[model samples]
Target chain A: MTHFEPISPLSVLDPRDRGGPVQPLLTIQGLKKYFHSAGNSWFGAQSVVRAVDDISFVIHKGETLGVVGESGCGKSTTARLLMHLIKPDQGEIIFDGEKVGIDIPLTEFRRQVQMVFQDSYASLNPRLTIEDTISFGPRIHGMYESKARLISHDLLARVGLDPSRFAGRYPHELSGGQRQRINIARALAFNPRLLILDEAVSALDKSVEAQVLNLLQDLKEDFGLTYLFISHDLNVVRYMVDRVMVMYLGSIAEIGDGETVFSTPVHPYTKALLASMPSMDPDQPTREAPLSGDPPNPINPPSGCRFHPRCIMAEAACSQKRPALETTRHKKSMAACLLQNRDTPIPFPPIKVSGQ
Target chain B: MTPNQALETQPVIARSPGYWHGVIKRFSRNHVAMGALIVILGLILMAVFAAYIAPADPIKGSMLRRLKPIGTPGFPLGADELGRDMLSRLIYGARLSLLMGLSPVPIAFVIGSLLGITAGYVGGLTNSLIMRTIDVFYAFPSVLLAVALSGALGAGLTNALISITLVFIPPITRVAESVTTQVRGLDYIDAARASGASSYTIIRVHILGNVLGPIFVYATGLVSVSMILASGLSFLGLGVRPPDPEWGLMLNTLRTAIYTQPLVAALPGAMIFLTSIAFNIVADGLRGAMDVKS
Candidate 1:
């Protein structure tokens, strides 16, 4: 077993010395993850699903960055990749100006970054009691068992579960909401600087979701934590995030501050996504589908802009080349679309949609 | 509502039952298993106290009393071909019989689980290498494999035990491998990995508990099969040698007297059948009790 020097207090308190406070807490550069699926025919080539295709993003300190996409759009894959739960095939992840697995060892990097899974029930070991599960990470990271136990109890209480009532209980003995609280408590046990929550509140009912969301909000403030929140629920994303990144077919279509992106989405895919949110006003029910067809098969995603087939404003030129993410009209936002890029010539005049 | 408020709203805080307590509670409810357990316990006790319980010396024999019918004076359950008391022989037989039948399983369980779990958790090339090699063992029928291995190793109790243990390992390994592969894909494993748990720690702390229950139930079911196989080896003159009072060996020695005193001749065979059935149903009961879904 290799020995790692314990992280010093100075380093933990002031980790971004090289880049100072301006450096993003975490940066993902050209992260790609492809999965091979066996082709149906006997001699056919194995197809690769580009689950997360050369995506890049930054999580600034103390901000909740929500990643919104339809099912199969690779949001969960990105979250897993960021946590290093699944190794990215081609990319670098920089944490606090130090390259993970290079300047800092993977174990040390993981200690600073933790993840909460979407399936609260499946995320917990049924055999371990709540306290055991919560304390397991700290104990493995070299904390004494007694100290770990104390921390586990403190975290359980902080997460709103009475330590005495919940600590000895198994996962099956708790409600879904209670189990999710346990998962959150376990993630906080490391006192991680960054938390990648993959649809953390999506599985709960509305009331429970609000409670967990509030708990998450409070914890983030208390811990000075940065969050990479991934979910398909647009309304929830709007409520929980300061910044939002909309994805389509394994690639980002738009990203910006929550207010601008929700009100004035620059990318056609993001426009349709925002328009598709189930209207709270019963008088303004959605009369038309947002975009047509399922997401293209990731094994062979559509050429050029992946969303061209479904984009309401797509042109013949849109299928010829992929659009790079560039600054949009809103200085804080960026959108990846041929029409949004100033250098690209629009092949045809824009057709105005009625509502816009 | 806050958790404390929710707790106050609830009727009561019932204590959650521990896993083992639940297993025992469920197992105790099974009438068939309970009966089988009693029978097995009786057999084990008989084996343990054979010396004090057997009325006559098992090995001592006389030609004059040979082939006496069951219930004959001073020789209850009749005498064997060499005039050995059948009841005394069967009581003494339980010791070696139970020993031979039960010892191979735990040894196989440990070795098989280690190999299988390694192959399953560390997948890809390592999985291919270990699993493909184990699959080769499946090419030979277990009965034939046991016979051939013991035959090659030459006749002895140790040789027979070794062959039976080898025969049991492949199936147990296959079960362990499949279960571990399933467990390795679960979210808890991913959560553990994300928490920076070493592979060894993940396997031990997360995967083992989930996989062990099914593997143990499967291993328990194999015990009866092992007993029958051990008995078969003894009957074929490959296990316990003569005058050792093993049920199978006793049956083999009493074969000629079957036509004359058929009831007495069948006593050892009856013991083997009864003991094996008891083991089998008890295993079934355990499987039912341990099933989390049930």
Candidate 2:
């Protein structure tokens, strides 16, 4: 495997290398959200779109976990579910050692976890000024208006926008990148522990995207934040995330440290995804499509392994037997592929039931 | 990062006006809307100062001078079937006419926004319940429904207003609901929800401004329809009593003189047509001005 120097300097002191066992900041288990297709009559069983089906993953403390997938692969759905923007069909989300909605009330859980969405303008309340938008969370949580304003101005400056100039402006008055900076500032209003960035920088121009990514990196370290970064940009994922999770049809195909997953993908689906990244080098040109055909209709995904139909390494068994996430040869990663050869057979840990 | 730092040092651009300020500025630039607004405001001022503005008493009329032609010496607009000065009565009629035209709208706007926004923001069962109930009100034509409601309630200003208010609520509610639904799905609302904002707070701070503008514009369009409906009710004898100088009632009492003095007889109808048109064009202007994109 060709080793690429880690883009982020913080990767040198891996969270896994801490003295004790690495802590899981957020644990999701068996998360499912099925949307009922429109035009279904009220009487009978409706056609269900299984947006996120039985997905489980862990976001370790102070680490950025990038989730990548094609459109409708349920990356966005998973982000929404984690934030409880849309309630999951069946699942448990444990945040910072507390059961969300039970041990920690939803309101309290929300204060510790905030989200910055993909649409910079749509994600902001257009009617509110930048100051109002940033202070909105603090005011909602009962902080005095004056104090909230002060904190918002401070945050506005920290996000690299001059508070004096931008704080009074409305969303429409600002550019896409500036609006995103305001969104980031607002997310930090609660001093949130985890930030769910759902394609947060995808809409910006390439130059602005780099600046915003750097700002996010600085803010993540400064706030000691764990990020659930959802993006389809492989180059960005490699640069911004410490760990990478590859999703296909609402299931995790492979997950490992960014360098390992990018350089040596075990799952055929993950390999296809990495190869799909557009090459900048003139000497090495992509000769063929990495994966053929669009993802199967999510309404009735293929039985057993969701990726079996398109997976190049699929076997007869792959079509019949579902593959659970299992440890791969590399100690730092796991792959959910029937053909992945296992020697030590370190079984993947089962998700703990809610109460336990 | 370097570019962003440069952006920070750049002086602030000229401050953009607030949303409503922009709306008002756009509204002022529309000549047709401004003209309509002036006409409506003039009529309102005439109504407010009716006692001073009217040339002669609207109630006392001589039988000998009844059904006089337009441009009569004493009565500039002529005399109605009751020989009442047409201009004086029309001037005085503005009070009740504008009241009937304007009052029902705000009442319906408030009530409909509450119902529609509630049904929209709290979706599923609550949405189905409220919207389905509103659909029941839409089964009958608005005119027939208003007349029937006025007939059932007994004819009076209050009852007529109530009936007109009822006729407008369903359309306004439907508009409010759809707009609220649209705004509710916006990412900002989701962001607010994720920020631990209570549903009430989301509806108020985040959802209200977005949805209310469209709903208000829709309700303004309803005002013209309300005016015509109220006039129809009065013409049907289910609104203002005979002696009142309301435009609709005046039209009813003057129907007998249509053949003898058609010009005089058409004056009240003319007033109704003009006022409704004024209201409609102003509403169109508001819609244009408030088109968030512009």
Fnat (0 to 1) per candidate: 0.62, 0.62
Worst 10 residues of 1 chain A by lDDT: A1-10
**Candidate 1: residue B182 Cα off by (Å):** 1.4
What ranges in model 1 sit over 4 Å off? A1-18, A38-44, A341-356, B1-17, B255-260, B292-294
* lDDT per residue (tens digit) for residues A189-265 in model 2: 88777899999999999999999999999988766677999999999999999999999998898998999988877
TM-score for candidate 2, residues paired by index? 0.92
lDDT, candidate 2, at B216 = 90
Poorly placed runs, candidate 2 (over 4 Å): A1-21, A342-356, B1-16
DockQ of 1: 0.42
Q: Chain A TM-scores, one per candidate? A: 0.91, 0.89
Summed over model 1, clashes come to 0
DockQ per candidate, 2 decimals: 0.42, 0.55
